[model samples]
Target: MFRDSLEAGARAVAAHFDHVLSDAADLPVLHAMRYATTGGKGLRGWLVLEGARLHDVAPERALWPACAIEAIHAYSLVHDDLPCMDDDDLRRGLPTVHRKWDEATAVLAGDALQALGFEMVADPRCHPDPLVRADLTLSLARAAGARGMVLGQALDMAAERADAPLDLQQITALQAGKTGALIAWSAEAGARLAHADLAPLTAYAERLGLAFQIADDILDVEGDAETVGKAVGKDAGRGKATFVSLLGLEGAKARATSLVTEACDALSPYGHRADALREAARFVISRRN
Candidate 1:
């Protein structure tokens, strides 16, 4: 059920992107923007739609923010895969944007995607209330900017340059920014749209985000490139500190399981209506990629 919903959300977001960018000038950067947004789990967008559904927001109203978050996510991946960043060669089983095209094109594509994300959130289609649109835009800016994801990425790069690897606490804080920030934003988006209390979803996302990173660390240790659709064991190869590195494989897995439990527990207020989100937490730990 979760997989079906996830795929549906992915298709919805992709179609929206296609419609929005169809009239964009025919250029390599525009093509790269389309290519970079293509293919992924679309987990962030799914979270937006599901959370909005839980809040009784109409699907049409939810779709705008859903695609907006996905665009932001895609832009992050494009920049993260650059030679100056993770320097990855593959993403979603294909060449990274920087590798498929030039670094300049990849940078411009990411920049455009980021701008498009903000534009989507601010558009009247996202929410009729201008205040709601402003809130979404402001929150997304914080999530994707220096105070959040960018902070995490900068810390990661700094850790690579430091003489010593980051300790467990440092890595936790880093991952919170690098990955958790956006996921938290995605999970909390519906509540924002509906003007509901944000505490419960915030709590849910905090635990889920950490668990997601821990699962990623575990996959880096135990998964294959073919299954994971990217390089495996990169953390070990680089001697980077990760959940698995600090806690050991079994301990890391245990932590993730416990976190998933906590994440589900956080959604108790929503009762069975949140069952799919609970399942999503479980799937995060079990997914091959």
Candidate 2:
């Protein structure tokens, strides 16, 4: 059911940025953005729909916002793969935008996609509440900007230097910003869009976000390139701070499991309405990539 919902939501906004480069007459960059955004499993969108499901809102009504989340996520990945960033060449089993095109085009495509995300969230089809739309914008901005993902990236890059070694707490803090913030925002934004009170949901997303990162770290350690679809051992090679670095492989996996348990417990208040979300928490730990 979740898979069907995710596919439908992804297709709904697949052409959302279709006119992105129409006036400029350069379709490839726009195509790159569309391609990157559409092909993912739509976990972020699923999270939004799942949150709405917890509030008994119709999944169809949540599709536009779900697509918006996916657009933002895709844009982040584009930039994250830049030479100055992760310098990755592949994503989702395809050449990255920068590698497929030129670095300049990739950068512009990422910028365009980010703008498209805000535009999609503001679209009337998503919802009627302007305040809620503004909140979505704010939530997305806070998650992507200096106080969140970018700042975390900065810290992560800086930590590579021998002068600064991240303690376990610091590693947690970094992942909370880099990985957890976006997940929390995705969940909270969905609940807010459904007009649900967000306190418990926010806390639930917080724990789940951290769990997601811990799982990612564990994957980086145990997963192979074929499974993860990116380079393995890159974290350790780059001296990046990871849960596995702070705690051995076994300990990191334990941390991920504990957080997944806490994430599931947090949703108990939502009862059966949160079944998809509960399953998603489990999926985070179980994912191969």
Candidate 3:
């Protein structure tokens, strides 16, 4: 059920991108924008739609923010995979944006996607209430900006340059910002749209995000380029600190399992209605890529 919903959400967001980019100028940058947004788990967008559903918000109203988060996410990946960043050559089983196109085009495409993300959430179509649109726009800006993902990225780069590796606490804090911020925003989007309390979904996403990163760390140790679709073992190669490195293989797995349990527990307020979310948490730990 969770897999089906995830795929459906991915398709929905892809269609939204297609429609929005349909009339865009036939430029390489525009093509890169579309290519960059294609194919992923679409977990962030799914969180938006599922959280909205849980809160009784209409899917039509939820989709704008869903696509908005995805655009923001794709932009992040494009930047992160640049030669100046992780220097990756592949993503989602294809060339990274910078590899497929020139770095200049990749940069422009990422910039466009980021702007598009803000535009989508700020549009009145996302919510009837002007205040709701304002709130989403502001929150998304923070999540994607210096205080959040960028901060985390900076920390990661600094760690790579430092003589000593980051400790567990520092890495956790960095991952919370780099990876968890957007996930938290995605999970709380439904409540934001519905003007409901954000506590439960926030808690769920906090744990889920950490679990998801831990799973990534584990996969970095255990996965291959063919299955993971990106470079694996980079952390180990770089001698960077990660959950797996600090906690040991079994310990990291145990910690991720514990986090998934906590994430599922946070959804108790929604009872069986949140089963898919619980499954999502579990799937984060179990995913091959």
Candidate 4:
């Protein structure tokens, strides 16, 4: 059921992208942006939708931030797969943006997607209240900017150049910013839209985000490139510190399980309404890609 919800949400967001991109003239960058945004689990966007549902927010309104988060996520992957970043050739079972096009196209596509993400929440379609739109825009900027995702990326690059690998605490902090920040924003977006309290979702997301990263680390150790839709074991190849490196496979898995439990528990206030989110937490650790 959760998988179904996730897929449906992904489709809805992709459709939104198609409609928005169609307004722009056809170009290589636009094509590259479409390519980059397509074919993924869409977990973050799904979280936004599900959280909005839980808050009684209308899908018409909820979709703005949902698609915004996905655009930002797509942009991150496009850049991450570039030669200067992960330097991968594949993503979601297709040639990565940089590999399919040129690196310059990839860079431009990424930049455009990032801008599009902000534009979604800032636009009047997102919410009628100017203050609400401003809040969403500000929070998105914080989540995607220097204080959040970018900070995590910088830390990651720094770790790569350092002699020693990151410790557990250090890695956890870095991921909280890099991966967790956007996730936090996605989960909390619904609450912001509804002007509801954010504590419950915030607690769920903190654990869920960390578990997601841990699962990714485990996947790198066990997954094949064909299934993962990207390079596998790159962290180990580069001697980078990961959950699997620091905690061992079994230990990392156990940690993920524990985090999922905590994340699910954080949803108790919502009763059965939160079941999908609980399942999402389980899916995080179980998914191979």
Clashes of 4: 0
User: For candidate 1, what is the total of clashing residue pairs?
Assistant: 0
Model 1 gets an lDDT of 0.94
The lowest-lDDT stretch of 10 consecutive residues in candidate 2 is: 15-24
Q: What TM-score do all the candidates reach, one by one? A: 0.98, 0.92, 0.99, 0.99
lDDT of 1 by residue, 1-289 (tens): 8999899989988898898888899999999999988889999999999999999999888889998999999999999899988889999999999999989999999999999999999999899999999999999999999999999999999998999988999999999999999999999999999999999999999999999999999999999998898999899999988999899999999999999999999999999999999999999999999
Q: Which residue window of length 10 is worst by lDDT in model 1?
A: 13-22
- Candidate RMSDs in order: 0.8, 2.3, 0.7, 0.7
Sorting all predicted structures by lDDT, with the top scorer first, yields 1, 3, 4, 2
Runs in model 2 lying further than 4 Å from the true structure: 1-26
Model 2 alpha-carbon miss at residue 249, Å: 0.7
Model 3 weakest lDDT span, ten residues long: 12-21
Candidate 2: C-alpha RMSD after superposition: 2.3
lDDT of 3 by residue, 1-289 (tens): 8899999999998998898789899999999999998889999999999999999999988889999999999999999999888899999999999889989999999999999999899888889899999999999999999999999999988999999998999999999999999999999999999899999999999999999999999999999999999999999988999999999999999999999999999999999999988999999999999
List candidate 3 stretches off by more than 4 Å. Answer: none
Candidate 1 residue pairs that clash? none
Error of 2 at 92 (Å): 1.2
Model 4: colliding residue pairs: none
lDDT of 2: 0.78
* Model 4, CA-based lDDT: 0.93
lDDT of 4 by residue, 53-145 (tens): 999999988899999999999999999888888888889989999889999999999999999999999989999999989999999999999
Colliding pairs, model 3: none
The backbone clash count of each candidate, in order, is 0, 0, 0, 0
